[model samples]
Target: MTSPSELPSTPAPTTEFEIFRGLHYRDQPLVLPNAWDFASAALLATEGFPAIGTTSLGVAAAAGLADGAGVTETETLAMARRLAGLPVPVTVDIEGGFHEIPSAVADFVKQLAACGIVGVNLEDGRAGSALAAPDHQAELITAIKNRTPEVFVNARVDTYWLSLDHSSTHDRVRRYAAAGADGIFVPGLTDRTGIEQIVAATDLPVNVLYSATGPTVATLAELGVRRVSTGSLLYRAALSAAVDVARAVLQDAPVSSGIVTYPDIQRLLPAR
Candidate 1:
């Protein structure tokens, strides 16, 4: 594995945005690992990921707030600021842009871009299995693009995620693309037919949330998925592993040897 010291420092904002955008066009889908904090982001970058994204669930849970409730705006921004010095470009998941007004959402995104975030995942899913209207969501995308065109806007259609309107996926994908979205993310879409259909729906790069039970990375690449995000999986797995290790210690059983060493983790961050 390449050490963090061997990797290049953060690139200029415009170049970084271009690099993040170009990752989606590679032969293999960009296997994005969502990081909840600086250590996770820095570690993933040291391992040579092209880019890193923040998981709303991980960030919100870590901050003791609820995900997708528009309650994590400040926490998300703080996370972005902390990640500004990483070796790879970073994207933030700003749930519903943290506001109802399009202009307000744009203003918030402007702040995120200013923190060296190259992209953002703006979902349309609301609380209680509801979804924002397609037109209104498109307006939000437009406002964000108009405010910060260099920042890659990954418009997230939560039809499958929220289970609200399955048939509207194609329409929403096209709408967001027309509204100047740099990519389309449809989480909870697993089947091949559905994946192919969404890929064919728009020319914009398609992103899907990685699922253990879903098709493999090669399969998704064949289906034309440009990006696959492991959203919250790492954070959740870390939590589970910590609990299992604690139980083993209590029982005087051998703990897992695959754990990262304290010194290794300490080396992940440089002196500030």
Candidate 2:
């Protein structure tokens, strides 16, 4: 692995970058699925999703570490490297920059870009359930854009997820937009009124987290949201299915759940 300090100042053009960015504004809102590893990502690609995103929760839990604690940097990068060969564009959830210095954030993203990831989720939430000052978060976004301009920077604002009001969110989004962010993500804000306001507030594409109780994708598209992400939902569902099937088998009861065939999974790899 190339050390962050030795990362190149400029990166060559990535083949998937333009395609990934264009998916945001297509006829339908981009419904991004979060994948934890190569098999999950490759399966989704075969299932016809145009792009894939990495879930920090799934990545951390699979490695027996905690999410949002800034402990998964190495693991996250390693997973990105392993999944680099997938057929679709891959974006990663890099929680909270993982370092105090803006340049270090740039260096970490540099490594992922080298691995061919086309996008990233850089959030503003920190440890201890607090939010980073808006200026500080925007500085991090600017640094990433400076070092890796080809990578789509999805600037995540965790205000609603942290149970805060919407008063200052527009301001925060504005600051991040000026910093050259390719898009804006507000994970917990689901109401159309607020969603509409955020989309109208900036020219940047607005990305919302997929909420079962929230507006559907078609509805969100009508209201002008360009992207909706399934963050960690698939990972949690996989865990539940794993436990359920195991319990059924041990009790000598019929397995009453869906299963993927071994041959189908084997097809996910490219022919060598």
- Name the candidate that leads on TM-score: 1
Once model 1 is optimally superposed onto the true structure by TM-score, how far is the C-alpha of residue 89 displaced, in angstroms? Answer: 0.6
Q: Give the per-residue Cα lDDT of candidate 2 at 87.
A: 82
Judge candidate 1 against the unseen true structure and give its global Cα lDDT, from 0 to 1.
0.93
Per-residue lDDT for 125-149 in model 1, tens only?
9977799999999999999999999
Clashing pairs in 1: none
Candidates' C-alpha lDDT: 0.93, 0.92
TM for every model, in the order presented, reads 0.94, 0.92
Task: State the lDDT of candidate 2 residue by residue for 177-223, as single tens digits.
Answer: 99989999999999989999999999999999999999988999999
Candidate 2 has its poorest 10 consecutive residues by lDDT at 8-17
